[model samples]
Structure formats: C-alpha cells, structure tokens
Target: MTFEMILVIIVITLMLAGLFFEMARPDLLVFFTLFFFIMTDIVSTDEALVGFSNEGMLTVGLLFIVAGAFERSGLVERLVSSMLAKANTRQGAMFRLLVPISGFSDFLNNTPIVVTLTPIVRKWASENNISPFKFLLPLSYAAILGGTITLMGTSTNLVIHGLLLDFGEKGFNFFELAWVGVPITFIGLVYLIVVGHRFLPDHKSLIEKVREKNTKDYLSEIQPWNRQRFFSERCD
Candidate 1:
C-alpha cells in the first residue's frame, strides 16, 4: 500500500481508539488536518491557519462555555434533578435524560458529561429501587448518537468542516446532519427502551458520591454506585 493509504488507516484507527478509550488527550488529534496540509503543501501558511480564524470555531467554543455555565449555574443540575424526581421508573428517567445529555455531550466533552452524570443517574435509580446499569450504557450510547446531529456537535464534524473549507468547498450547515441524525437518535433510544435493556446489569450498588464545587458558587453532588468495585477506581 502507498504511504498515503497507510497514514489514512492509522488515522482512522487512532480516532476509533481514542473514542473507545475516552482518552483525555484526544484533543491533540484535532490538529491532524493541519499536519496533513503541511505535509501535502495544500495552501499557504495563512490559508492553513484560517480554521482558527473562522467564526464557526468561536461559535463552537462559546457553546461549550455556555454549557459549562449551565452546569456551574445550577441549571443543568436543577433540570436533571427535576426530571429525575418526576420520573417514576428507571426507564422513564433514561428517556428524559437522553434529550439534554445527548445534545449537550455531542457539543461539549462527552467524557465530562458522562462522568458527572453517572453518579447522579445512579442515585436516581437507587432512589427508585432500580438498576443504574440499565441506563448507563444507554447514556453513553445516546451521546455518541446525538453528537452527529450538528456541525458544532463533535470533533469529527468540525474536522470535516475544516477539511472541506481547505479544499475550497462549502462546509456543512448547523443542522444538516441532524436531518438523518435525529432519526438515528430516536431509533437508538427505542432500542434502549426495548430489547437492548435486557442486557443491562441486574443490580448496582452505591459506593460513594460525586461532589463538585466551582469558584462561581456552584456545588453539585452525585451518588456513586459500584458493580465491580475495582472498576470504579479507574477514574478515566
């Protein structure tokens, strides 16, 4: 195989591995397009750096900061807590939780959202006398599904946009992907509700709680659960 084809294979492997491992440093891969351009001499230095100058990048960053504010301002907590309180069953809570989280994690860091909410969700299940594992996998899966919904929704989406622009082509619109993504999201949610949940763990035990404090006078707590107590300590 040619060197170019080998490099493409390596990149695809790394992307999948990064996502699978939920690696913290995956952000470094965000600049691979720049490296590709430099190696291929696709454009002048100024043209190559234009992605950093685009309003799209700013918009994506602003969305994350806004989401962070939502977390720090008690908004996400209040919203999630409200939903959990009203949910009479674990399944019900999972259905409701999917909406915000799928959208939020698609844009922001999926890892943080997953980690932060896992304990809260476990507490909800504990309060309702249900299994947190029934929905934890679904939660992670839903975020992956929903992240494909918009151009600002995921790193791959942004990378695609930059690469398109680099080729002097039009980039994706905000919600164009959502055209197909929404249907996929709905289908995935249905799967979680129906046959798929049978594979979920039967019992989940609460080990500890997750607590958060921010300089902006924000504090939130999550009740932790352990299935295999050892697995909980990996903290990745």
Candidate 2:
C-alpha cells in the first residue's frame, strides 16, 4: 500500500467521522474532502475544480440572493408576526404556521427559506425557552420534505428527471417525487421526532447569549482538554 493511498484513506476517514459525528457542518467538510483529493493527486486540477463552474451552483447562489431580497423586503416579517400572534406555544407554532412555511420553501429556495424564517424561529425559540436546533431542524425538514412532493419543488429533482429523460425513461410529473420520497421523508421525520433529535448536539449558546463567537463556534459541544479531565493526566 502506497503512502499516498494511506493518507487518502485517513482523510476520507476523518471527513466521514466528522460528518457522522456532526462535529462540523457537512458543507465545511466538502471543501476539505476536495482539497485532500487534490493534494493526493487523486483527481486532475480541472476535474477537481470543475464542479464550481457548473450551472447548478451558480443557480443556487443566485436563488439565495433573490430569496434574501424577498426576506429583507419585510414581507416575511409581516407574515411571521401574524403567525406568532395567533399561535399559543412553540411546538404549536411549528405544527401550525411554521411547518407550512417550511413546506412553502420546498417549492422555492431553501436558502431564502432559511434566511427568512431563521429570525422568526430564533425569536420563537427565545420566547419559549427552547433551543434553536429543536425547531430549526423541523423547519428545515418540512421544507425539504415538501420539495420531494413535486418535480418543481427542488432543482435536484428537476436534474434527476432530466437524467431520466436522457436515459430514455419517462420523465417525472409534478407529484412524482412523492411516490417514493413521501414515504422516505415520513419515516425519517418520524425517526427524528422519536429519537435522532434527543441526541442532537447542544452547544448551550442560547438566543440571548448569541454572538459572533457563538455563531462560528460550530464544534462547541466538544470540550477542550483541561488538565483535570485529560487522558494525558490519566496516562501520567
């Protein structure tokens, strides 16, 4: 086994471990994975970098900007205000107004959905003394789940449908994604509601404690090595 291959294996292991442990956000590791492959000469320069030039990435970035524009226009504020005024509790709000809002995002860009609804959710999270993660996941899951219901719900579905046509298979209809996606989404959601979330990483950065530090402290749940708790001390 070559040293380069060994190094490649280590990088892949680290990336996967981070993802499985939720130590770092998935998007952050994507670049590192690419960089590792490039450094290991696993892919040529052009091949390694070509994905950024793809039209899909540009389209998503543009969509995020457009969504942010709509959010900044205060329409989101008005709508969120109305919903909050009517809902009596946080979970009730999620089930009632927020879940539908997330579903609406499936037909649109999730970036805009995230940007528009994040503030509303943060405020609600604060008012109800709930962690942001508790509701944010529900909000994200709803939007993503709704997207699988229709071909136009997400660009990825459109891309897959196009691929099917290129392969001489029938293309999808508006609701075709839900044929399989609905069941998978439902099962995953039930799992989250039942178990996965109970294990969610709690960084302990509550809404009022939020700062630039907290925002970027993605791995805060992992405590640093102190003398008292160190494996080094035990070994000594």
Candidate 3:
C-alpha cells in the first residue's frame, strides 16, 4: 500500500479506538482528526475548513439556538403536559411520546429535538411510574426516523446538499426525501408499538433507584448534631 493509504488507515484506526474507549468528546476527536488530515496534505486547507463556512453547519447551529429558545419559553412543556394526560399505560405513553417527537424532528434538527424531549420524557415516565428504559431508546430511534422525513430534518442531509453544490450539482429540494421518510416512520412506529414494546426493559430508573436507597437508609435525626432547640424550636 502507498504511504498515504497506510497513514489514512492508521488515523481511522486511532479515531475508532478513541471513540470505543471514550477517550474524549467525539467533536473534539473529529476536530483533531481534521487538523491531522490538513497537516498531512491529504486535503487542501480550504477543503479541510469548508465545513466552518458551510451553510448547513450554520443552519444546524441556528436551529440549535432556536430549539433552546423554544425550550426556555416552556411552550414544549405545555404541549407535552397536555399530550401526556392520555398516557395512562406504558404502550400509550410510548405512543404519545414518540409520535410528536417524530413529527417535530421531521421538520427540525433531530439533535435539538432529542435534547428538548429527553428530560420531559424522563420526568413524565418518572411521574407515571413508567420505566425510563422503555422509552429512551425509542425516543432516540424516533428522532432518527423523523429526521429522515425531510431535508431539513437532519444536518447530514443538508451537508450532503452542500457538498453537491460544491460539485456544481443541484441540491435536493425540501421534502424530496419525504416520499420515503413517511412510510419508514409509519412502519417503524407500528413495529415499536407492536413488537418492540415486548422487549423494552422494566428496570427502575436511576432516580428511582436512588430514591429507594434513600428510603432504605432513612435517618430522621442525628443525635450529636441535633439543632432542634435552636433551629427547629421557635420562640412564640
């Protein structure tokens, strides 16, 4: 093999190893990898840095900011609260959670969609006595499915469109992928409701586990450190 090919293999191997070992953040690792490729002359400086100026990247960043604003406004919370009122069973809860998440993720970036929904889903599950494991993986999968529904759904689609533009090719139209996306999402959600539900774990969530431990180790009063006279008892 050529020296360049061998070096590429080594770099790829190291990146995989780093990721598998959880050595660092994935974004940090990717940045360093790109830097290394630049230094090795595998790609021109412009090519290596083009992503920084890519419209897709900027759009992804902006979408994340918008998602953050939407989150802070508590609109999503209100919507979730109203929808969750119908989630009385595990299957019902999963359906209620995944359907809306899928719909939003189809039009918005999946990363922010998942981020915005995760805590809400967790809280809803905890309050309803549902196992978090039953819905967390499904939530992730639904976001991915939703992203496939539209060009704007995920960064990868936009990134590919940007790359096509660089090559003097026409980019995909918005909703071009929806033809396939709609069916896939429909079938996937059906499978999750029917077959996947049987496989979801029933384990207690971490918060529930911690609460149980606290209850078991209950210590209402400490003998020596008691401050009942000064703190608890108040003068009339």
Candidate 4:
C-alpha cells in the first residue's frame, strides 16, 4: 500500500481505538486526527481549517444559539404543559409529543429539541403513570423525521449544501426537501400511533424501580450560581 493509504489507516485505527477505549471526547479525537493529517502533509493547513469558516458550520452555530435562547424563554415549557397535560392515554400522549416536536424541528435544529424535551417528557411520563419507553424513542424519531421537513432543519442538510457549493453546484432551496419529508413524516406518525406502540415495552423508569426496591432517597445539594451575577444587581 502507499504511504498516504497507510497513514489514513493508522489515523482511522487510532480514532476507533480512542472511541472504544473512551480515551477522549469524540470532537477532540477528530481535532487530533486532523492535526496529524496536517502535520504529515496529507492535508494542507488551509484544508484542515476551511471547515471552521464554512457557511454551513457558521449556520449550525447560530442555530444552536437560537435554540438555546428559545429553550430558556419557557415557551416550550408552557406549550408542553398546556397541551400535554390533558392527554390521558399513552396513545394521546404520544401523539401530543410527536406533533409539536415534529413541527418545531422542521424550523429549528432537532438536537436541542430532543435535549429540551427529554427531561420534560420523562417528568410528564412519571407523573401520568405512562411508561417512558413509550415516548422517548418516538421523541428521537419525530425529531429526525421532522428535520427532513425543511432544508435548514438539520446540520446535515446544510453541510451537504456546503459540499455542493464546494463542487460548484447549486444547492437545495428552503422548502426543497419538504415534498418528500412531509409525506414520510405523516406516514411515520400514523405508524407510530397505530402499530408502533405494540412493539414498545411498558417499562417503568429507573428511578421508580430503584425507589420500589429501596424506600430511601439519595439527595445531593448543588448550587447552580457559583459566580457573581450582573442580573442580581440589576434587579436590585
């Protein structure tokens, strides 16, 4: 094999080994791999750093900030409480969860959608005596399905658009992916509500199981604000 091929193999091997052994974070592993390639002249410094300045990467970063702000504003919380509080059955709950998530994810990044919804869904399930398993997998699936509904819905689509630009080809429009994505999302939702529930296990949450086994609470106090805040003085 050629020297470049051998180097590629070694880098890939090290990456996999680091992942399997839990030696470092995945992003750190990728950075190290890129650094190695640049140092060895397999990839130029410009090539190694170009992705940081890519429009797609910048868009993804902006989307993350917007998502964080939206989540913090309590709009999702209010929406969840107002809509989902009335769902009595598991099917109804699943429907409520899927519809809003699928809708929001079409406009926003799905990662933050899932992250914001996970604990809320868990708490809702626990309170309503519904199995978390019934809702958690559907939450992830709905986010993924929703992301396809718009061109800017997921980072993957933007990255592919960037790749197309790099290749001197025109990329997709905002609603380009909506045609197929809408139909798929509709079909997937129907399947999840009608047939998918049967396949999901009605398992209790870990906390519930632990509580049942031992009627003792393990409490740890944590203070969130360690640093002096400008907000407190402003409010005063």
Candidate 5:
C-alpha cells in the first residue's frame, strides 16, 4: 500500500479511538483531524474548505435556525399536549406521541423536536404513573423513522442530495423517500407500541427520587424584634 494510504488509516483509527473514549470534544477532534490532513498535504486547503461552502452543509445550518424558532414558538408542545390529553393507557399515549413526532420530523429537523419534547414527555409519564424510560427510546426511534420520510427530514439526507447535485446528477424529490420511509415507520411504531416498551427499564426519574426524599417537612418560629431599637444599636 502507498504511504499516504497507510498514514490516512492510522489517522482515522486514532480519530475514531478519540471519539470512542471521548478524549476531547467531538467538534475539536474532527477539526483537528481535518487540519492534520491539510497540513500533511493529504487534502488540499481548498478541498478541506469546500465542505463549508457545500449547499447541503449550508442548508443544515439554516434548518437549525428554523428548528430553534419552531421550538420557541411553543406550537409543538401545545399540539403534543392536546394529542396526549385523552390518552389514559400506555399504548394510547405511545401511539399519540409517536404519530405526531414522526409526522413533524418529516419537515423539521428531528434533533430539536426530540430535545424539546423529551422533558414534556417525561413530565407526562410521571403524571400518568408511568416510567419516562419507556417513552424516551420510542421517542428517539420515531424521530429517526420520520426523518426518513423526506429529503429535508435529516441532515444526512440533505447532505446526500447536495452531493448528488455536485456530481451533476438529479437530486431527490421532496417526497421521494416517503415510499420506503412510510412503511418502515408504520412497522416500527407498531412494534414499539405493542412489544418494545415492555422490555424497557422502569426506573424512577431523578426528580421523583428527590421528591420522595424531601417529603418530610419541619416548621420553625421566629420572634419579632423592635425595628427602632435595632437601628439605634446599629448606629451606636
């Protein structure tokens, strides 16, 4: 093998090891690896910078801004809360939660959707006497499945679309991926609602544990003091 190929392999192995062990921040490790490659002439500076200018990368950045705005608008929370309002059973709640989450993920980036809903779902589970652990995994899975439904659903899809354009090929239509994504999403949600939740740990959330610990209460009394006397003493 060529020396450059051997060197590239070594660098990649080290980079993966650093990521696995969490030796540094992921972005830092990635940036350092890229810089190392450029310094060694493995990739030209222009080639390294090309990713920054890639249409897909730019679209992902814009989507992050839009996702942040959507989260702050409180629309998702309201919609989800209304859907889950009548869901008394675990199966019902799981069905209601996963359906909207998957649908929303088809348009907006799924990361923020998952992040914004996590606490809300946890609180709902606690209120309904269910474990948050059961819902969290399903929540993530639904988002992933939903993102597959459209080109804009996830960063990976958008990046691939952009790459296809760069290579002078026709890119994916908006709903092109939905043909496969819809069926997989349906099957996955069914499995979670019917059987997957049964295997999750039923551990209490940290907030519940803390609430239990602080259940006992004590009372204390304080005597009133003369304000004029206190001020006079301070002045003297």
Candidate 6:
C-alpha cells in the first residue's frame, strides 16, 4: 500500500491500543489523533474542524444537555418508581419498565435514558428479590429499540441525516424510521419478556451485597472518655 496509508494504519492501531489500555482520557486521545493528522498534513485544519461544525454533532451535544436537565428534574425517577410500584411479579415489572423506556427513547437520546435508569432498575430488582442482570439487559434493549423509532432518538440517525443534508440530499423526516423501528421494537420486547430474561445471569451488584450486609448485621462502637463518666451518664 501507499506510505500515507501505512502510516495511517499504524497511528490508528496505536490509538486503539491507547484507548483499550486506557493510557489517556478518551477525548484527549481522539483530539490528539486528529491533531497528529493535521500536523502531518494528512488532513487540512479546515477539514479537521469541519466535523466539529457538523449539525449532527451540535444536535447530539444539545440533546445531552436537554437529557441532563430532564434527568435532574426527578421526573424519570418518579415515573419509574410509580411503574415498579404497580408490578408485583418479575415479568410484570419487566413489562412496565421496558414499555416506558422504549417510549421515552423514541423522542429523547437513548444513551442518557439508559444511564439514568440503570441504578433505579438495579435498586428495584434488589428490593424485589430479582437479579439486576435480568432487568439491565431488557433496559438496554428497550432503549436501543426505542431509539430506532425516530430520527432524533439516537446520535447515529442524526449523524446520517446531517451527512445527507451536507451532501445536498433531503434529510429524514422525524418519523421516517418508525415503519421498521416500530415492528422490530415490538418483536424485540416480546422476545425479551418471553425468553431472553430467562437466560440472564443472576449476578448481584456490589451495592446489593453491601445493602444486604448492612441489613443483616451492622456494628458500631463508641468509647467513653472515662469509666467514671460512662457510669455517671448511665446512672443519670
């Protein structure tokens, strides 16, 4: 191959190694990789900066901000808690959780939705004597399926839409993906509820272990300043 292509392969290999080994922050590694390409004249500064100016990237950033605000509003927590409260069985709980998660993901960015709901689902599973593993997979699957339903549901859709617009093509309609997404999401949810949950490991999270330990036996000791003081306080 050409010298430039060989150099690119080496640089990318090193970058992947650094990321896999966690030798530096991910953002720093990516930034430095781009900077290296610019310095080597593999890409012009304008070309390198063009991606940052892409509408898709800006939308993803804005979506993260909006998702953060919504998460902070405590609405998600309340909604999840209310849903879990109404379900007494594991299947019922999974049904309740997955349905809303998929619906929420249709309009919002699914990454934040998954991250925000993970701990809540874990806690609920622990309390109800169900494995967090059982609910966590369904949670992720639901979010992914939900994101497919709308153009704004995931970053990938927006990125593709932006690329299309950049190429002077008409971009996707908001619900253009719903035709396939809706059916796939329905089938995926059914699979998770009917069979997938059965195959998940019953792994207990560290938080659950700690909580159980605390509930069973928690010990504390306090020392008195003096025997006389201790006795006096007791007598008093």
lDDT of 4 by residue, 1-236 (tens): 99899989989998999989999999899888988899889999988888987777788788888877877998777888778878887788778879888998898878778888888888877877678898888888898889998977888998898889888999989889999999999999888887888899999998778767977667999778734575777778
- Candidate 5 residue 185 Cα shift, in angstroms, is 1.3
List TM-score per model, in order.
Answer: 0.59, 0.61, 0.85, 0.85, 0.84, 0.85
- Candidate 2 regions off by >4 Å? 1-5, 17-29, 53-55, 89-92, 128-134, 152-174, 180-236
RMSD of each: 12.2, 11.0, 6.7, 8.1, 6.0, 6.7
Better of 1 and 5 by lDDT: 5
Residue 68, candidate 3: alpha-carbon lDDT: 95
Candidate 3 has an lDDT of 0.86
Alpha carbon lDDT at 101, candidate 6: 91
What overall lDDT goes with each candidate model? 0.71, 0.69, 0.86, 0.85, 0.89, 0.89
lDDT of 4: 0.85
- The window of 10 residues in a row where model 4 has the poorest summed lDDT is 225-234
Q: In candidate 2, what are the lDDT values of residues 117-184, reduced to their tens digit?
A: 87877776676566777767766776676667666566677566666765788887777667876776
lDDT of 6: 0.89
lDDT of 3 by residue, 156-212 (tens): 998998888878999999999999999999999988876786797789888888887
What is the clash tally of candidate 6? 0
**lDDT, residue 129, model 5:** 69
What does candidate 6 score on TM?
0.85
Candidate 6, residue 14: the lDDT equals 95
- Candidate 5: pairs in clash: none
Least well predicted 10-residue stretch by lDDT in candidate 2: 203-212
